[model samples]
Target: MNNTALLKPETARDEVYAAPLKDLNPAQPALFQANTMFSIFERLRAEDPVHYTPESDFGAFWSVTKYKDIMAVDTNHEVFSSEGGITIGDQPMEEGPLPMFIAMDPPKHDIQRKTVTPAVSPMNLARLEPLIRERAGKILDGLPIGEEFDWVDKVSMELTAMTLATLFGIPQEDRRKLTYWSDVVTAAPGQGLIDTLDQKFEIFVEYHAYFTELWNQRVNADPQPDLISMLAHGEATRNMEPREYFGNVVLLTVGGNDTTRNTISGSVLALNQNPDQYKKLRENPDLIPSMVSETIRWQTPLAHMRRRALQDIELGGKQIKKGDKVVMWYVSGNRDDEVIENPNDYIIDRPRVRNHLSFGFGIHRCVGNRLAELQLKVIWEEILKRFPTVEVAGEPKRSYSTFVRGYERLPVIIPSRL
Candidate 1:
């Protein structure tokens, strides 16, 4: 929680590796915020791939690092259940869980997930592309040249907010509220976003009330392309309990926001860090699709997804007891040397770039993946057409949460217009 005063890289790595394997805990939000968990995950992947920490901010849980091991956990939804929830930390006991499809199992998860899938289907995305490109162009055109600006705020968030508003059928004017609610849902107490868990609930109440009005409106009207209308008209989700609706709302908002938003920021930062790859992109624009996938692998926006053990299982030679929390670090798995070649470097044109753990595997794979790619592809295409270069002018401030691996701010400069 707000713990990243920005640790020195060498010291952070040394401290993490020096600690005993038994005492290592990668779930701490501070490690993520400081961007120091790379070393922790590195040690865990090397020594204890299926690691258990007796004590943590979230309590005793198992960390599943490495590429193949993460795939095993993510794909085997039956043995590694999502019903216990998809994050290492438990929700407030009083609030209970807001049940969304991502946290459900089997028949129920399939039904609810199917209800909202059409809104982001390939056909719908093709229909939405021209509009998205137009918006991306407008955003790029509006950016001030020869001055430093936060790409996260001025570009990444704005573009994603506009696209999210279009998908949810909300006014573009209310887009920032979507960002706020999404942030609050992932925020921890004392993280600056929220002071306490109660405050988070209060924001949830506001979020619920706002979205409920939209749901009622959609339910009363005929079916349309927006997500609200789909949920209201779909046979499975039409009569969902109010809290369940809110849960899906939370899910969709974060789903749409984080992957695209963070990856957009990450793409900019990564390209800046590796100028050679950025130069390759300038010479060959066709690499955008491959570059998008590379950045997704490079970023792994949502770092980890948690699952619960259905029965006692031995994974990577560790005995995982029934009901234990198993956290699959997708971020770490993307870095496993045995799987991805030159895993630490940002290579935009890497072979089999799409074959990464960023969007996950199996049934729980991200629903909005293609749309995320479409947005990135269009933005980069438009970006190349106008600006010669968008340079990262200063260091980025990463988000506070362990769940959302994203930037709070990334300052950039548009040196000139093409």
Candidate 2:
């Protein structure tokens, strides 16, 4: 679909947000293209925080816009079930239920989640920190000093892919395959990665076979510290069905890839766009942790997570029927003025910095969030130690999906050293 056509006249760009609440459709790709998603979210937060869209390419769904409502829905997993799926787009029925823990309800979700939590436990992150700093240093030291480059490619994806490879115990030579499969998992046809469902399926089969080989290698070996090993030896996860195993792999890949990579890219773009905040960070390098939190909130790597109502419920003055699709717009929630002071502004020193919906809320919140934050913090620390200023050379090209709030490319130039 040509989203640009939805915006008939570029002259009326301002009016896009002024459309009636009932007529407003946040799912249209044009809003993100115009970079006017904030305005739509602003309107929804004020007038219809729990707004419902009757039609969309995905389906009819309710949009939960405010931070409070999003939290309410997110935390109450029993009432707002995740069993249907995490994103708004329903999985193709022919592919069967990808029973990854993220989409499971209750005992199963808890069990599978426990199996992998140790990989990201505080002790593990502490052990991984020095290695992350080493990798970050090397990556930054290798960047071209004065020439323009795609920050998303040269830095963001590279670092995240390297870290993911470490987490999965994938051989360094074969690590790029993880990145390839991760992109394919979230990509829609014509999204610049895969062009058709058949191509996607082909890649899916390849991904499954590759992981199966890894699983076989680890299933019999002495227990290791990697994700595949954890799943292989875990009492709860060891006997998972084929589709369930594939689903877990997809969950870990997409979860780990999108959050960290996009934030890395988004941090640069955000700081560049907000020069004052950038200046503040350079002056006080200690602000990196706060800046990381603010960037995650501002970027909202994943835009929304969908839920299916298990029972009829009333929320935000609207009645949601049983089995209705409800989407918690984290992008919108992070910018909600009632919750976040100066929500539109990117302030690295903002108080209560961690108070945002980026990592999500409740039991289903991202398990790898601390590791994601650690990578961002370490990269920024290394970036500041090297370049005094990393300038945005051009506008960013964002991912086509409303689900992944991220960049496909971010052009940047580093102006000498500090």
Candidate 3:
């Protein structure tokens, strides 16, 4: 079999999509940094949905690339545990693991997650809707017409950061710090965010100190609806270890901030790139909900979640041994052609729009998903009401980590209203 000849043309045509299995290592952060991950994911889904990489920077691991296989691993928490950590790289052993509920299994995960669930519940969303709309209106109306700006900074970050502050009942002035900490938590060295472990630790130390002050303030006061108060007063979470407290804070902050902000940025990029679909959206603003769902599917904000195998399991004809690290590549699964028709196209009005892997399928699914959707829907609705179009000024600057499929800057200019 002349593997090179067959693979070479496809590799040249779509460089990321046709690499030979021997040369394929999906865990390499460089693939993500280069934004060529779809090619690797496409090749894997077609050839080997459950493939093993013998060696890589993050050590040996299995990559689960198809839609159903990812769902199986994600839902069967009993077989594939999250206790090892959620990202491909294990948490720094020298410092020890941070005890966030997202990385815990069974009873502990259930109880702790329940504490913060109310903050994003249907009733709470109703409380936050008017506030979100007001903020979205202000942010969009404030953008300089016909002048270019980083949409990520002016709109995406500001909105999500403000909402995060509201959820925590923190001062509006300090909201940007939550965005900073979330970026630092996912960033690796040379990603141009944090350059060294010492630097990372310093930022986290400050984060711990700041949030500890808030926790202290909340614990002594009468109960409130904010997340800090929920944790301070909840039966499962009160009296938490300092690291555990820090871990949960990171979880909520990153979960709330990154997913929404990135999607907001990504939706603009997706819509602009697909002008026909953008035209559809403009012609019918009622497609906002479907567009919101499609943007999440297309962006897949958090690329993959790592789970450690609790017992040997057979999946997609591959044997995964106990303790082996298995990554459910949601970004890949969301693009699987077997499940999603026209998987690569950013069609806003796709039928069964919600049937995608942006949010995991089981108990560990993103709890704040509805809130993220609400923020996006409100912002887009506001944008359409004002500007005829939001033009992309130039190429987007994407985030550097494999785990966070997001943009760092999206330059755009909104022409004066018609």
Candidate 4:
């Protein structure tokens, strides 16, 4: 029996509300609507690779969904400038250019990135690996085997927070404050944090005041080998004003918190979803590095990066005027069929995993990509060695913000010991 034929006239109308695929036009609200965004991307990747989406809430923007198109925009920083800011929706806060490095176009972006890049270099990350592993083991050791726990809070957030604390040399007691400031700064209106622009700006002011004290202390004290000290003493960074200092602090806070948190939470979710993949890694411990890359690709935590058109440019036969906001959907790009073979499938040893844009591309590519990778690798390596099996105990809940796609809560149960 055909279900469509069996449905009554009224039921058919109800079906219209349920089926997003029924609305195919790019201009339709369904394109930018949260419920339909992913589905729309899947459809565009199959049909129209570049689509224009206009929304009352977020304003009009070109959604670059395909792999090649996203790569073109992300790598060509000259044509597409990040200085316009990266949020897709209207920012409630009214302030001057917030002075974050991610919001600058080169050669300024280059200079700022170079100042902090050395601190997260492979050699530096290598020195931190053992410490990261020790922290991971300590966190996992505290959990009772075969008992359900919120993995997002207990494992993912804790690990990333501790790692960031180590990176910045923040006191352990103050680490949770880092996570709070990060949430407040990046939280959107719908996320249940501060709703208005004034509140968000006020939060920023408070954060700046706190960091000012920290900065003063760091400035007068003997120099140490941490991100804060490096930024304080680095040739390009020493001259930064209070606003600029706060901006960099906010950048590192969000970067170290959200990306690695999602990676850790997403990896556990991925493993639980694909037990075969989990079993594969458990059997072959050397696969941790590949697994790390695959996790970043599968998660694509930084869902999209926004850019402003510097000048008139034609992409995919569409002419974009200067100052037009263009959003590169890295989440969709990672799953593009042309870039990764069997893009949607989770293959731990997939050879092209590192080619993913989850960390992004070109000049603004993640400044701490190596550190993020090191943290994930160390966590997984230590986890596999300590526990024979770790499984999801309940459905994972996602963060509300589209900008930072991650698990807010993940429940899991692990074996007592190996």
RMSD of each: 1.8, 1.8, 2.8, 4.8
Error of 2 at 336 (Å): 0.8
TM-score of 4: 0.90
Q: Report lDDT per candidate.
A: 0.90, 0.88, 0.89, 0.79
Score candidate 2 by TM-score against the native: 0.97
Q: List the residue pairs that clash in candidate 1.
A: none
lDDT of 3: 0.89
- Residue pairs clashing in model 4 are none
How well is each residue in 282-390 modelled by candidate 1, as lDDT tens digits?
9999999999999999999999999999999999999999989999999999999999998999999999899899899989999999999999999999999998889
* Number of the top-ranking candidate, with lDDT as the measure: 1
TM-score on alpha carbons, each prediction? 0.97, 0.97, 0.96, 0.90
What lDDT tens digits, residue by residue, belong to model 3 across residues 1-418? Answer: 1122233333433754444675677776655655766767777888888988878778888999999999999999899998948999976635687889999998899999999999999999999999999999999888999889999999999999999999999999999999999999988877798889889988888999999999999999999999999999999899888789889998999999999999999999999999999999999999999999999999999999999998989999988998899999999999998899999999999999999999897889999999999999999999999989999999998887779988989999998885
Once model 1 is optimally superposed onto the true structure by TM-score, how far is the C-alpha of residue 182 displaced, in angstroms?
0.6
Return the top candidate by TM-score: 1
Question: Candidate 3 — which residues are off by over 4 angstroms?
Answer: 1-19
Runs off by more than 4 Å, candidate 1: 1-7
Q: How many residue-pair clashes does candidate 1 contain? A: 0
Candidate 2: residue 156 Cα off by (Å): 0.4
Better of 1 and 2 by TM-score: 1
